[model samples]
Target: MPPKPKKKCCSDKPACKRCPLQMMKKGTLPPGYTVKKRKLVKVKKSDKKSKVAA
Candidate 1:
């Protein structure tokens, strides 16, 4: 039998959230740095009928 494959990390940066290294450290950030909060922006949808009429 073959061994199970390891899961891949999804974070863009090294040791970022969702990374195995981050999980191993128990969610603590490196010294002299803080986590930045991301804000969500809502976009308004344009009407297709109005675009076709133009």
Candidate 2:
């Protein structure tokens, strides 16, 4: 398995080591990992969604 990706990106022009964007480009991101708002987020295993109360 590959090294865990960085939780946050340095936002550098060249992308820092373990940067999520860089890992994505390199196709080394682990399962359930995704980049959101320039940060790496792990998808909830429960897949639960907030319910709006009527």
Candidate 3:
């Protein structure tokens, strides 16, 4: 079974097993969730916007 996710992050340099940051490195982070600056953040639709020359 996959390891359970942690409710909060300890922000350790070497993230723990249940750390979201570690989970992200292992590509196990759930959809809509991403790690930024070592913190787990919910993805926003606008954040996906890319600058495209029309």
lDDT of 3 by residue, 1-54 (tens): 778667568877777888987898799888888877766788877756788999
lDDT of 1 by residue, 1-54 (tens): 322212444556554454444443464433333232231123345566554654
- Candidate 1 vs candidate 2: the lDDT winner is 2
lDDT of each: 0.39, 0.85, 0.78
Ranking by lDDT: 2, 3, 1
Which candidate, 1 or 3, would have the higher TM-score against the true structure? 3
Cα RMSD of all models vs. native, in order, equals 14.4, 4.6, 3.4
Write down the TM-score for model 3: 0.57
Stretches off by above 4 angstroms in model 3 are 1-4, 11-15, 47-54
The candidate maximizing lDDT is 2
Q: How accurate is candidate 3 locally (lDDT)?
A: 0.78
18 Cα displacement, candidate 1 (Å): 1.4
Q: How many steric clashes between backbone atoms does each model show? A: 0, 0, 0
